[model samples]
Target: MEIAEILDFTVPLSSITLERVVLAILVAIIGWIVVKVLTSTFTTALSRASNLPGLVVEFLARFFSVLLYVILALIVLAALGVDISSMVLGLSAVIGLILGFGLQDSINNLAAGVWLAAFRPIDKDEFVEVKGISGKVVSVGILATELLKPDNTYITIPNSLVWGNPVINSSRMETRRVEVKVGVAYDSDLDTAIRVATDLAAAHEKVLPSPKPAVVVTELGDSSVVLALRAWTKTSDVGGVQGDLNRGILRAFREAGIEIPFPQLDVHLTGAE
Candidate 1:
């Protein structure tokens, strides 16, 4: 056989089309497997490192694995004579324009989600008060926040809203003030009333001793003198302790022969002012 004839005839017989197809398939499968294995390994290491939830680590692993596989697929397609870079740039521009026009709010929410996940301004199961809404965080999803309120109501706050405003966490402080005011007759001794209110506040089980409870004379009303009792308690126990202390103070004052004054108006029977 002549060299020229052999070269020309065998090239067509090699079946380059099927070879390319099989190679592409093999690349995709192998790339997927490598991505998953590598991601799993990293997840396992991170899971063992701290007290984070296993599901969180696993979720992060799968998410990153998908990202890695996308990059790998782009590279593979480029090697296979596809115009990957230009296509990716064009797609990105189109996506950007679409997001700017119709999906701005959704994109803002997604960006907020990423920021929250990375920075951890709040965590799962934490009791948080944001924008006058107070609740325990049930879940921090990719697009929205799920909150379980104390009254058993479910609240779904968008991630953008969560990140956009300033959050005040009443439960975040070490100690909180449990405050109440009581009115007593003008005839009652101010010093005795202060003593009684202070003693009552101090006797509560949840009240802290270091700061010490105090009674402040706030207002002199027509019917009574208002005494304010300010006591400190652990942030978590504020609500319960407040209720208990208020009830106890009232009962204690009653036992001490203190009169709880009510509003009274002396009727002057004059025709007109």
Candidate 2:
């Protein structure tokens, strides 16, 4: 009778309850392992995706990891006979309210970042002009974009503004046009000035030959004739080539006895006398 009592005490819980508990434990373990494997795979794949940025890939990976963990918890709860409907509904409602009110700007920025990542309006090390700001793109992020200016200054612009405004990417192509303006005295030979400027542009090693550099009389100023020397060069060499052209033109003009004029005012003293 004592042995029977011991068995009865040990078997107080129903078989079904014991099975549910065991099942819940097993499922939880399995779900955890699966979540880890899947999240790793997902993160690796997202990182490889060409259109996605590093920040976005990382954000998505973390988000999905959390989501998978939540799902695993819900599954474990269901196996243990816990009602999750009301919990899910309540949690969703709270999240929705918080996101709706407090995270509007964040959501907008994230969306804009996604758009930029997908479309790729600007890229790293590329020169860009956007919203009156000019710089080289250093990095792109979910919240903002970083730019490095010519003077080594850094500018951070919100992704929303970057996506919303017009973006001019100067380094998007292999070649870019560089224009150098040379002004000469009105008495200088117009044809000779144009010839010398065009020759310098055509002779530059960085300048492309196919496009063929040209010189044009662009403007007639009060003190000088503004001649524009236009040439196409590799995007990476545009600045250096421009400087070279300006210096070469100045030297050539001096050798040729062409005078570059600056704006000046001559005063007459006849009224004072």
Candidate 3:
């Protein structure tokens, strides 16, 4: 009930002197500063010295920071004249209990993160589709993966989900194929349409020259003949190349008098009932 009685009951004030308490506080402050500086330096050195992926470097930096803080806690406890051996045992028991009861998902995320870092399926700044969400990978953290969508939205996916799902990495390959499908009227000259499409693709600056561009008759629908124009370009230029090819083909088709057909339904009236 009394303040002194409460203090005595809560902490062993008789055994710990004012000087020891002050020393512990100072040690904690100094250790925290040292830990921060050491962590930053280690992160910089590791990033510059090793050729590890950015996600792996980030994960290592975070793990090192946590390890430093743990050591700092032990040092502070030692300065306070606390028995660290027993404290460590007690802490281990507490951690075990937490893992067994409340941290199963957290543990899985951590393991998944480690696997993601080790295997390098996806990395920072790469465009990927995971679990039906498509975006550029911003970071792979201990618990989750962050992505930046095209609309500038930020999304966080649990590492467990990311690891469990198939990751479609668009930026992994250097070259990508761009295909544009166009339908021409049945009366249109198929050879001329194909040549026009191929020419448009070949004229695009981003399109690769080695494989060359080609046009193939994909399908003969009820109303039109579908032609597919396929070209190879650098992965980064795929969108631009596709757009350019589409626009160029449309314009060239008009100049060449090729008519692109639209869906139409034919109906006949029954005179006799």
Candidate 3 lDDT, 35-55, residue by residue in tens: 999999998998899999878
Each model's lDDT comes to 0.79, 0.85, 0.89
Q: Per-residue lDDT of 1-273 in model 2, one digit per residue for the tens?
A: 564454334224543365567778999999999999999999898877656766556656766887899899999988877779988998899989999889888788879877886778887778998888899988777678889888999999998999999999998899999999988999999999889888888889999997999999889888899999999999999889989998999999999999998897777777654
- Which candidate achieves the best TM-score against the true structure? 3
List residue ranges in candidate 2 displaced over 4 A.
1-91, 99-102, 267-273
For model 1 the local lDDT of residue 31 reads: 84
Q: Which stretches of candidate 3 lie above 4 Å from their native place?
A: 1-16, 267-272
Clashing pairs in 2: none
Using TM-score as the yardstick, the better of models 2 and 3 is 3
Best by lDDT: 3
Arrange candidates, best lDDT first. Answer: 3, 2, 1
TM-score of each: 0.69, 0.71, 0.88
Per-residue lDDT of 1-273 in model 1, one digit per residue for the tens? 765454334225443344455556778888888887888788888889867654345446655776898888886675454688798999899999998899888878868877766666767777898889999877766677788999999999988999999876665568899889899998988888889889888877889997999999899988999888999999889999889877988898999889998799999787876
Point out where model 1 deviates above 4 Å: 1-44, 50-90, 264-269
TM-score, structure 3 vs. true: 0.88
Q: Regarding lDDT, does 1 or 2 come out ahead? A: 2
> In model 1, how large is the Cα lDDT of residue 90?
93
